[model samples]
Target chain A: MKPILEIQDLSVEVESKKVLHHVNLSIQKGEVHALMGRNGSGKTSLSYTLMGHPKYRVTSGRILLDGEDLAGMSPSDRAKRRLFLAFQNPVAVPGVTIASFLRTSIRSVRGDEVPAKEVRKLIREELAGLGISETFMSRFVNDGLSGGEKKRLETLQLRLLQPKVAILDETDSGLDVDALKAVTSRIESLRSPDRSFLLITHYQRMLEAIRPDVVHILMDGTIVKTGDASLAKEIDEQGFQSIHEASAQL
Target chain B: MSPYSTTTRSTRKNRIESLPIPSRKDENYRFTSLSNFNLQQLNPSIAHPPKTVEPAPEGFQLAACTYPGGLAIALESSSHEGLHLSPFEDAPEAIFQKHRAAFDLPQALDADLFANLSAGRCENELLIHVTEGKKITQPLFLRNFFPSTDQAFYSRTLIILEANAELELAQEFVWDGIESLIQPFACGLTQIVLGPGATLRFSTVQNWNPNTEHFSRTYSVLQEGSQLTLNEVHLGGLKNQTRHLTHFEGRNSQSLHTVTALAQNSQQMDFWIDAVHQGVGSRSDVEVRSIAQDKGQIVFNGKIRIEPTAPQTAAYQKNPCLILSEGAVIRTLPKLEIQTDDVQCAHGASISSVDEDQLYYLASRGIPENTARTMLIEAFKAPGLRGVSNPFTKSWLSKNLALTEEEQ
Candidate 1:
C-alpha cells in the first residue's frame, strides 16, 4: 500500500539558517514510527514545517499526505486534511475555556456534522476519562495548568480529533512516571488500522510503552540510522554515543 | 424648587466659564483633546419631543421613565411596597432631601468639567429609593431615550438604598429618532448611596448614535458592610468620556467595577475609574478591557487609593487592551496610592495587537484564521464581564458582545 505520509527530501530553514537538510521519511497506514534525536537535532523543525508555521521556511522538498502535496496550505486547512501536532510547550489562552476550544475545533474539522451539544457531551466524557475534574472544562485553555496537565489536555484533543497522521512532539518530557504510563496507555488505546502516528522524542522510555514498528535516529539534520523496533532497544542499552560512533563509520 | 436647579446651576455655570478649554497639555487630558469637538458652537436648549414609555418587562418593575430633552416624565405604578421611584420634580420632600445629600458626595463633580456641565444644565432627573431592610426580589428598570438631533442633552439620576436593603438596576440609553444627520452631544450624572449592610447590583449600557458625543459620570458611596458591583459597557458615540468613582466610606465595605469598550471606525472613547478606600478592611477590584479597530482610539485611566484609615484594605486594578488595526490606538494608565502600611494594592496594564501565537494555536486546531482572530478578540473581553452578579446585566452585555446563547 502507498504510504499515508511521505517527506520527499525535505530541507527546512529557520531565519535563513538551514535546520533540516534533504531529509526523507515515509509512514505507511496503521504503522507507528519513532523519530529519535538529541537536542538541536531539528526534531521540532520537521513537525513545525509540516504544520505550515510561518516562522519555519521550507527551503526545498515536498510533504505529501496520501499522495497530495501539502505545501502552502494553512495550518487550519492541513488540520481539515487530518494532520495534528501536539506541541512540546502549548500556548495558554487566558479566557477561552477548554470545552469551548475543543468544540470549535471539532466543528471546524468535522464541518458541523456533529452537533455542538453532542461534541460538548463527548468532551465532558473524555475529560473525565483522563481523571480531570469536570470543572476543568470551564477553566481557561491551558492557563495555569501544570506540565502534566498540559500533556493530558493535548491527549484529550488527539482523542477528539482522531486525525489520520498525528505527530507527538516531546509529549513525555514533562510527565512523571505515572503520568507517562497513563498518557501512553491512552495513546495505545487509540491505535487502529486506519491511523498513523509519528512519535518524536530523545528517550527510549516512552518507546518501551508504545512499541513503534520502525525507528529512525536523526543527527545534525540527517537521518543516519533506520531499523526495526530492536534498534530503539539497542540505543536504550548502549546510549546515543554508540549510535554516533556507528553512524560516523557509515 | 430644588436648590440644584436654582442655586447650583448659577454656581456651576460660573465655574464652567472660568475653566479653560481642556488641552492635550493637561495631565488628565494628555492623551485626548477637545478641540475638534466644537463645544462652543453647539446649542444646549434644543429639546427632544416627549416619547411614550413602553411597559416593563417580566421580572422587572419600572419605577419611572423620562426622555432626557423632553418635557414629560412617565411614572409607572408599582404594587411593591417600600419601593419608591419617581421623577425628581415629583419626588416628596423626604426623597428630595436624600437626593440632595447623595449629590453632595465628593466625586468627579469636584473638578471634572463635563460633570459640572451636566449638573448645571440637566434637563431631567430620576430618583429611586428603597426602604430600610427591604430586599426587592424584582429588579428596577430605567431607560432614558434621546432624540436624534444636532443638539446637546443633559440628565441626572439619584439612587438611595437604606440600611440592609438590596436592589438590582439595569439602566439603558437609546436614541429614539430617525438616523441622525448632524452631531449630537449628551452629558449625564448618576449618584448612588448604599447604607449599612446594603447591596446594589447596577449595570449601565450606552449605545448612542454614531454621530453622538457622550459624557457620563457615576459616583457611588458604600457604607459599612455594603457591597457594590458596577458594570458599564460602551459601544457607540463619535467621542465618549465616562467617569466612575466609588468611595468606601464604612468598615468592611466592598466594590467591584468592570468596564468594557468596543470601538470601530473613527470613534474615540475614554474610560476613567477611581476607587477610594477610606474604611478599614475594605476591598476593591477594578478591571477595564477595550478593543479598537480601524482608526478607533481608546483610553483607560484607573486609580485606586487606600487611605491611612483604611487598614487591612485590599485593592487591584487591571487594564488590558487590543488594537486590531494599524491606525488604531490604545492607552492605559494605572495608578495606586497606599498611605496605610498594612494595605495591599496593585495595578497593571497591557496593550497589544491580536496575539499571533494564540491565533496560530487555534488555527492549528482547525479553526480558520479569520474565525480564530474573532474568537481571540472576544475572549480578551470576557474577563471584564465575569464578575457580574446580576442576570439581567449579564444578559444585556452578552447580547451586545454578540455572544451566542450557548456561550453565555
Candidate 2:
C-alpha cells in the first residue's frame, strides 16, 4: 500500500549546519509511527523540515505527501492539505483567545469562514473532552497557561483539527500522569483508518499509552533501525545505546 | 460674572502668538513636530455655524447633531431628572466660565502647547451637568462630525459631576471630509470635574478621516472619594496628537486612564497621558497600547507625578507597542516623577515585533501569513480596549476599528 507520507532520502540543514542527513522514513495510512532518538539526534529538525519551516533547509531529499512533493510549499499551504504539528513548547498569544484562534485555523484548513456562534459551540465541545472548563476557551491562546495546560491545549488542537498527517512533537513532556493520560487518550480517540500519525519522542511511556505499529530508531540524522513495536519495548528495557551500537555494527 | 462665557479674538491671537511653534526638541513634543507640516495650508472655519443634514447615519440620528461641527447636537434624552444637558453657549455663563478656569491644566501641569491653543480659540461649548446626589442610569451620547475636509474649527466640551452624583458619557468624533481638497484641523478641550464621592465613565472614539489632523487637550480633576475612568480609542488622521492632564484634588480619588491607537500607511499618532497626584491616599492606573503597520508611526508617553504632600499614593503605568512592518515605528516611554518617599510608583514600556514562535504556531495550524499577522496584531492591541465598559460602544469600536482583511 502506498504510504500517506514519504520522506525519501531526506536531509535537512539549519543555519548552514547539516542536522538531518539523508534520513528516509515513511508512514502508511492509519499507522502510528514512533521516531525514537536521544537528545540532539535531530528529531525536532525533521518535524520542522517536514512542515516546511524556513530555517530547516532541505539540503537534499524529497518529501512527498500522498505522492505530491512538498518542497517550496509554505507552512500554511502544507496545513491546508491537513498536515498539523503540535509544538513541543507552544507559543503564547495573549490577545487571540482560544476560540478565535481555533476558528481561524478551522477557516484556513476548511476554506470556509465559520460563524462566531458556531465556532464557540464547536470549541466548547473540544474543551470539554480535554477536561478544560469553558473559561479556558476564552483565554488568550496559551497565555499564562501552565506547562501542562499548554500540552493539553495542543492535544485538543490535534483532536479538533483532525489533520490527515499529525506530528506530535514531544507533546508528552511536562505532562504529569493525569495530563499524560488525558493527552494519550485524546490521541487514542483520534486514531482512525485513513489518518496517519508521527509520534516524535524519546520516551517509551508515550508508546505504552498509544502503541505504534512501527518504531524507527533515529541516530545522527538517519533512521538507523526499523522494527515492529518490539523494538520500542527493547529500547525501553535496554536504552538507546544498545540499539545505536548494534546499528553501528550492522 | 461671565468673563469666560466668550473668548475674545484678540486674546486668542495673543495666546496663539505667545507660544512658539512646537518641535521634537521640546520635552513634551519629543515624539511629534509641528515644523514637519505647513501651517500655511491650514484652512480656518467660521464660528461654530449650525450644520444641516438631510438624513441621519447609523440610526443614531447623527446628521442633525453634527451640523456646524459637534455643537448644539441634541442628546437623545436628557429626561433623566438629575441630568442637566445644555448647549455650551446656553449654560449659565458664570458656571461655564468657572469650569473654563484652569483650562490650561495641561500647560500648567504638563507644559503642553495644544491645551493653550484650545484655551485660546474655543468658541463653541457644550456642557453635561449631573446634579449633586443624583444618579443617572442612562448614559449620555455625544457625536462630533466634521463633514468638511476643509475645516479648521475650535470647540470645547465640559462635564461637571456634582458631589455624590454618577454619570456615564460616550463621545465620538467622525471625520467625513476629503483630505486632498481640504486639510482640516480641529483643536478642542474636554474637561471633567468630579465632586466628592462622585463617579464618571468617559468613553471616547476618535476616527478622524485620514486627511484630517486632530489636536486636543483633556483636563480631568477628581475630588474626595471620587472615581474616574477614561477609555479612548484613536484611529485616523494624517497626523494627530492628544495630551491629557488629570489631577486628584482630594484624598482617596482614583483614576483609570486607558487608550488605544491604530495607525497604518504613513499615518502618525501621539498619545500623551500625565496624571498628577496632589491628594493623599489617591491612586492612578495608566495603560496604553498601540499598533503601527506599513510605515505608520505611533508614540505613547505616559507619566505619573506624586507630589510631596500626596502620601500613601499609588501610581502604576504600562505602555506596550506592536510594530507590524519593517518601516513602521513605535516610540513608547512610561515615566514617573515621585517628589517624596511616601508613595509607590512604577512605569514600564516595551516595543516588540511579532514573535516567530507564535507565527509559526499559527501558520502550522493553516492560517496564511497575512491572516496570521492580522490576528496577532489584533490580539496584541486588544488589551487597550479591555477597560471599555459600555457594550454598545465597545462592540462598535471592535467592529469599526478592526482592520478589514485587505488592510492587513
Per-model TM-score, in order, reads 0.94, 0.91
Candidate 2 residue-wise lDDT at A106: 81
- Candidate 2 chain B: minimum summed lDDT over ten consecutive residues — where? B55-64
Give the poorly placed runs of model 1, Cα more than 4 Å off. Answer: A112-117, A248-250, B1-4, B36-62, B71-77, B104-108
Tens digit of lDDT per residue, candidate 2, span A1-250? Answer: 8889999999888999999988889899999999999999999999999888888899888999988899999999999888889888788888888877877788788655456456667777888888999878778898899999999888888877788999999988999999899889989888999899999988899999999999988998888999989999998899999878887898
Task: Calculate DockQ per candidate and list them.
Answer: 0.76, 0.62
lDDT of 1 by residue, B1-408 (tens): 556566666677777777776666664732445777665765465565554566655555555555555434344435566777765666677767755756542444667777777766775666788889999877777776777753677877888889999988877777774795667788888888999999998877788888788888888889999998887788888888888888998999998888888889989898878899999999998888888999998888888888999999999988888889999998888888888889888888888998888888898899999989878877887765766756666666777777644463
Candidate 2, residue B160: how far the Cα is off, in Å: 1.3
Best by DockQ, which number?
1
| Reproduced native contacts, each prediction | 0.78, 0.91
- Residue A14, candidate 2: Cα error in Å is 1.9
**For model 2, which pairs clash?**
B51-B67, B51-B68, B88-B125
Interface RMSD of each: 1.0, 3.8
* DockQ-derived CAPRI band for the predicted complex in model 1: medium
* Per-candidate clash tally: 0, 3
State the lDDT of candidate 2 residue by residue for B216-330, as single tens digits: 7788889999999888888877788888888998999998888888788988888788889999999998888788889888888888999988999999888887777899988
* Tens digits of lDDT, candidate 1, A187-239: 88889999999999888999989999999999888898999988988888887
Candidate with the greatest TM-score versus the true structure? 1
